[model samples]
Target: MFFRIINRIQPCTSQQRLLSRSPALQNSLLQQFFDDEENFGKQELRAKKRPGRSWTNEELRLKSSEDLHKLWYVCLKERNMLLTMEKAHKATARHFPNPERLDRVKGTLKNIEEVVHERNDAYYQLETGDSASAPKRTVTSFMGFTYEKRAEEHYSPPGEGQKGYEVPYLDDDAYLMQKLWNEKELCKERDRKDNLARRQLANDEMKHYKRGGRRTFDRLEDLKVYQ
Candidate 1:
C-alpha cells in the first residue's frame, strides 16, 4: 500500500529530513491528518500504476449503491491526504509534484456524487413521479439577472405569526420598470446574436482571400460559386 507512495517521493537538499519522529508517535490516531512521515520533504510525487483517467459515469452506474458509498469515502480520504501533503510542500517551499492527481481524485468524487444523484432521481421518479432534488423556481432580481430560488424547509407556514417571512412581490412602479428593463435586455441579446452572425459571415468571405486580397478563381464562371 505504501510502496506506491514511497516510490514517488525523491529526496533532495535544503529541506529538513522527515524520518526523525519517535516510534511512539506512530501510534498517534491523528497521523492520518498528515501524510506518511516518510513522504514529507520529498522532491516529487507521482501516482503508482499511473491511473490514466478518472472514473467514468457508465462504469460507476453499474456499481451497487453500497460500492459507491465506499468509493466516495476512499476518494475523500485520498483528497484529504493529497491536500495535507500539498500544505506540507508549501510550508517547506517545495513544489507540490503531480498536482493533477489531486484533480483526478476530485473528479472521481464528483462523478460518484453525480452517479448517486442520478440513481436517487431515477428511484424517486419511479416511486413518486418527481425528482429527489429540491424544488426551485426562477426569479429575476431587481438588477435583471435571473436566478433559481430553491425551496427551503420551514417548521411553520409563512403567514400570521411569522414576522420575518413574507411572500415577495414587486410594487406597480417597480414591476413596470423591471418589465421595461427585461424588454431592453432581450433586444440587446438579439442584437448581440445578430452582430456575431454578421461577423462570422464576413470572416467566411475573407478566409479564402489570397495575398492580393482576392480569392482564387480558375475562370469567371467560378465566381458564380459564391452566388
Candidate 2:
C-alpha cells in the first residue's frame, strides 16, 4: 500500500511561489506588496457565497507530496492576504470581510504540515529502523516519581546538565498541614453533596404532597423529614 501510494505521487516542484500576491495580480510593481488592488480599503461587504472549509488532515493525507507543497503555498497566501486586508480595514476604520478566514487558513496550513510530517515519519521508519518521533527521556519529578517525558523540538529534557529544581523537603509538620487541608476539603465536599441531596429530597416530597391535595407543608419543620 505504501509503495502504491508513493507511485501515485507526482514529482514535486522546486520553484518558490510568491506569497498572497499572484502573478496576475501585478498591475504594477507597487501592487506586489498587497494581494490585490480591490482587496485594500474596500468598506462594502458583498453577501455572496461564503468561503469553503479548510483542508482536513484526512483529505491532506490522501494527497501527493507535490499537492501538499502547492497547498501549503495556497494556505500561506490566503493567510497573508487576510492579514493584509485586515490591516487595511483597521487603518481605514472599516470592517474586514470574513475575519474568520484567517483562522481557517491557519488551520489548513497546520493540517498540511501534520500530513507532511506523517509522510516523513513513515518514510523514515521504512528506511531507518526507528520512528521520526520526538526524543523521549526518563526523568524523576519533584514528587520523586519517574516517568518517560517526550522532548519537544528545540528543547532539552529537564535535569539534562541543567540546574535541577529544588523541592522543599516534606517534614512531619508539612505532612500534618497537608493532611489537615485534605480533611477540610473533603468535609466541605461532603457537606455540599449532602445539602444537594437533602434539597432534592425536599423538592420531591413537596411535589408528592402537592399531588396528594396538600398545597403547602404545614411548617418548615415538616420539610425536615430527611433528618
Candidate 3:
C-alpha cells in the first residue's frame, strides 16, 4: 500500500536518483518505509508536515466506491508511517513537530468510516429491510449485572478460546438475586430522599427563626438535629 502511494507521488525529485540506485528499491515495503532523504541519518531530525488537508465527507461521498477504498488504504498507510517516524524520533529523544497532523488523519479516517457505514445501512435497508448496524441485545452477566451487548465478529465461536466460559444469560436464581439487589437499592434511595426532605424543612425553619418569626415556645434548635 505504501509503495503504491510512493509510486504515485512524483514531486520528490531529489531522492529519485538515490532511490533508483538503492538495492532496497526492488523491495517496495523497505523502499517506502524509510523517508526519501539522502542525508537521512547524517542530519538533524525534525518533524515533517503533512502535505494537504484531510478528505472531507462531502469529497469522499462524491468519489466512487473503488476510489474511496483506495483512499482509505492510502490514509491508513500514511498514518502508520507517520506513527513509525514519531516513535523513532521519541526513542532518540527528538521532538516530533505538528502532532496535530495525526489528529487530522484520524478525523479523516473516522469521517470515511461513517460515510461507508451510512452507505452500508442504506443498501441493507433497501435489500433486506434491515440496517447494517450491528445487532445488540440486553444481556445479564454471570454476576447478575445486565448490560447491552453489541454483536461483533470473532475468529472462533463463543466458549472456544477460553476456559470456564459462561454465556451471558440469567437463570431464575440470578434474576431473583438481581431483584433483591434492586429492592435494597430502592429502600436506600427512599431513605436518602426522606433525609433530604427533613433537612430542607429544618433549613426553612431556621430561616424563619432568623427573621424573628419564631415564638418563645418554638425551641429554635439548630438545623443539625435534622441531619
Candidate 4:
C-alpha cells in the first residue's frame, strides 16, 4: 500500500516543469500554501468558532489519558491559531481581538501539565530508585558567595576563557586599589556638598533668629504677654 502511494507521486510533468522553471510561479504557490494554512487554522480555532467557557477541573479529572493528549494538541493548535491571527493583524494594520483567550488557554495547558507531572512523579517514585527530578547544587563565584544552582547541558562543550563569552572578576591588588581610591574621592565630594548645604541652612536659620530678635514689640498687650 505504501509502495502504491509512493508510485503515485509522479516525476515533474511538462506543466509542472514549466511552473517549477519559473521561480516566481514556484514561490507564489509556496506562499499561497503558507498563507492559506495560516488563515484556515486561525479561522478554525477562533473563540467564536470553538465557543465555550474555560475547561473545568471536573472535565480534566474525568478525561482519559488519551483525551488529555488530544487536549494538549488542541491547546497547541489554539496557540498557533492566536499567533497566526496576531501576525495577520499586524500585517493588515488591525487589532487582534480577544488576546486574553490565548492566555486563558495557556493557563489551562499549564494546569494540565501540572496534573500530568504529579502522576508521573508518583509513578516514578513508586517504581524507580530515585525521584525523576532536576539535580541541584551549591556553587560559589569569584566574589565568594555560595548559592543553590542548576546544571545545563550543552550540545557542544563551551570554550573556556573566551572573550565576551565569559568575563572573570578582577580581584588583583591594582584593581582593588583603584576601586578604593575612586570610592574615597566620591565620598569626599559628597561630604563637601553636604557640609556646604548644612552651613547654608544654619546661616539662614541664624539670620531668621536675629531678625526675630530685632522685631519691635509695639503693643503693650504683647509686652504684658512676654512678661
- Per-prediction TM-score: 0.61, 0.53, 0.54, 0.45
Q: Rank the candidates by TM-score, best first.
A: 1, 3, 2, 4
Error of 3 at 204 (Å): 28
The lDDT leader among the candidates is: 1
Sort by lDDT, best first.
1, 3, 2, 4
Q: Would you give me the overall lDDT of model 3?
A: 0.65
CA lDDT for candidate 1: 0.67
lDDT of 2 by residue, 99-121 (tens): 77789899999988888888889
Q: Rate the local accuracy (lDDT) of all candidates.
A: 0.67, 0.61, 0.65, 0.55
Pairs that collide in candidate 1 are none
* 1 or 4, greater by lDDT: 1
Off by over 4 Å in 3: 1-31, 35-52, 152-227
TM-score of 3: 0.54
Task: TM-score winner between 1 and 4, please give it.
Answer: 1
* Model 2 root-mean-square deviation: 13.9
Best by TM-score: 1
TM-score of decoy 4: 0.45
lDDT of 3 by residue, 6-82 (tens): 34222245545644555655677765555544323333334342356788888889988898789888888878867
User: Model 2, residue 100: what's the lDDT?
Assistant: 73
| Candidate 1 lDDT by residue in tens digits, 119-209 | 9999999999988898776765554445677777679777784333222676676578878988999999988876565454455447566
